[model samples]
Target chain A: MTVSIIRFGGSNCDRDAERALEHLGIDAEIVWHEDGLPEETSGIVLPGGFSYGDYLRAGAMAARSPIMADVREAAAAGTPVLGVCNGAQIGCESGLTEGAFTTNESARFQCEHVYLRVERDDTPWTAAYDEGDVIEIPIAHGEGRYEIDDERLAELEDEDRVLFRYCDENGDTGPDVNPNGSKHNIAGVLGDRETVAVLMPHPERVTLPDVGPTDGQGVLRGFEAAENGA
Target chain B: MTAYTATVTVRLKHGVLDPEAETTQQALERLGFELEDLRSADRFEIDIEAESAESAHERASEMAERLLANPTIHDYDVEVDER
Candidate 1:
């Protein structure tokens, strides 16, 4: 399968994401943000970076880019689309998902290794992991805190749209353990199943066992499972 | 003919803390002035020449809801003064 990785003007992780996909045995290419979406691609990934220098609100300008129209259309067509960090913010800004506003508790840039408990394993991106499994991922961003109203929060919980919850070393979601003070300790969420996934953490950064976390295999395996129809 | 002044106040909603406002308030407190509550909000004044005060108020309210405040996190009140 081929994965089209979209690269904006300021995207920093495009190569890393492409590498990860390549290592996973999938053909991947970097597609420019201004160019039209690549056809005949099985999956699309919006890599993380400071798009438009994070001006006028994070991901706000990139959300309105010319290529986002095709991205939205691909997402609506049930194609697997994954957004990482600023990409996640763009996804929310583009109305690909529900509310993902500014941080609620601590409004500051945070960078650290965070534990995340898998809330659902049915999505294409998380199918390799069992429900309730905890994994470590790196998070680095200022606007990573997810905020929503009580009603919508409850609805997300009930719908199992919450894909991952931040936790501590012991994998317990709590105030002190939460890294970015995201509402519900959310780390990732799926829009309309696994077809559209957005996560604050950078899985691509942790995919190499020699360079990054050892748990990278599991995360990549998750995507590989989806490719294999597991 | 009637003249009306419309005032719009934009501020963070309750439970949503503004770090910039907090720092400003702390600075004010350091100046040794006893203040019960130091909250910061943006104020906009627009003078409109309308047929009636009610028309001005309606127009100001619409502006407040549409642009002055982000309904997701802020609530705005508009006051019109008839002259």
Candidate 2:
């Protein structure tokens, strides 16, 4: 029962995710994209980096990789999948999740700590935190802004698929607080099921105590919860 | 088989915000140029050999649908010509 982190051609965060999971006492391994999911895989993480050098667009190439079809099938079978930063873009691009993470509103690569308000607590990803709990995570990407047709965006919101939104330290959300021009300050979202989530923030960056913040521990802990049938 | 060059142009759908284009427009304005607005598109020229120009067009259209453009925010057109 190990979490398999898919390492694409340019995935730089696979090691980070592996260490983060290990620090939580969860068994995890970095699997190359071509090798396919291991038989013992119990969870998946699409860690972040400039896959394919951001050619065409961020996550566009890797989304079409041969392995994603298997990933989709596993997710459908109730395997918990978490995508962070560039992983968020790939999730959307591959249809593992909804919407797209396009260029930032500022049109520049922005890297900083941002506050995320947990939109729900029942899902495996957010079960460790109370609803509206503010957690700090570091986001580093140029194409981190989320985009979807207005009609779909509204429908997604109505369905409560949104998992996290950028907010101030106090958990108040507004355009001013949105790090990127994500619709309604959206920073993370769920798939049709709560077990699958994609967010444009690096939970691994904050999971280690050697680092400054520890707010991201819950997101990584989600793997254990999902495996335990939470 | 006929040799063809398929031109696929992908552009952001109208009304979708494109900050890269906006930033480029701002840069042009800073350069003392006058323009009402600006938009951008990516044109991919694919060379392929197929049974006919129609087949070439079809292949390029599929490519655009699958990789060249994201339907969520992009609209694309494909044109094929004998090379």
Candidate 3:
């Protein structure tokens, strides 16, 4: 099963995602947004970058592109979909996920490695990790802060849709370690289905051994799990 | 049909954190500007041919709803005038 990585104009990380997935033994193809999803698509990856120069808002323009309709349909069909970094922004903007990733609390671009505490281990994305496991991943963005209505956020928590929270190396979550001041330190979240996920941190950035850490391998392995029907 | 201009303004909700605005406010303070508070909004003007000013306003409002503004963190208003 080949994972289709949607590449919109100004998307710069599509190649990185492809290389990372290829390194992990997963077949991946970078599909230009205008070209549409390949008919053989088995999975979807919305890789990161400043789409449309981040005009109007980060991911806003790309989210409205015609290709997204197919992506939404694929997700609804239970196809595994992962959105990373700017992809996470597009996911939220397109209503594929809850909440919006707004301007960082710091009001500037932040590029660094941060710790993420796995909120659960049952979903495909976290199957390789244990609950509360701390993984180091790099985040690069100017607008990655997550925002949602207070009551809706409470409901999201109640539904246990949170996938990961920014935390310390010891797996402790708090505002101190919330790099972007996302609500409740949420670094990632599952869409309506656990099969669909989005996060600001670049798991692919950590998947390769040459990159220093394999902590993100577990996350990318979600595609492998889907391909193998695990 | 009459030509009209629709002005749309989008701003963050009252309670949501606006880091850019906050930073700008800080910068102004550092520059010795006197201001109790500062807020920022994005404004867009669209020229269109519509049946009436009301129709232009309606179309602009719809644009705001669908693309110009996000409901989660922003509030927007649309105004139209005949050109």
lDDT of 3 by residue, B1-48 (tens): 999999999999999999988999999999999899889999999999
Better structure of 1 and 2 per DockQ: 2
Error of 1 at B45 (Å): 12
TM-score of chain A of 1: 0.94
Candidates in order, TM-scores: namely 0.80, 0.98, 0.98
Q: How close is candidate 3 to the true structure, as a TM-score?
A: 0.98
Candidate whose lDDT is highest: 3
Q: For candidate 3 chain B, which ten residues in a row score worst on lDDT? A: B74-83
| lDDT tens digits, residue span A1-230, model 2 | 89999999999999999999999999999999999888888999999999999899999999999889888999999999999998999999999888999999999899999999999998888889999899999999999989999999999999999999999999999999988899999999999788999999999999999978889999999998897777
lDDT of 1 by residue, A75-157 (tens): 88767788899888888777787666455345567787888898887777777678888888888887887776788889988
Model 3, runs deviating above 4 Å: none
Docking quality class, candidate 1: incorrect
Instruction: Give me candidate 2's interface root-mean-square deviation.
Output: 0.6
Where model 2 places Cα greater than 4 Å from the true spot, the runs are: none
Using Cα atoms, each model's DockQ against the true complex is 0.18, 0.88, 0.93
- Model 3 residue A108 CA deviation (Å) reads 1.1
Please write out the lDDT profile of model 3 over residues A90-158, one tens digit for every residue. 999999999999999999899999999999998999999999899999999999999999999999999
Residue B53 of model 2 has an lDDT of 89
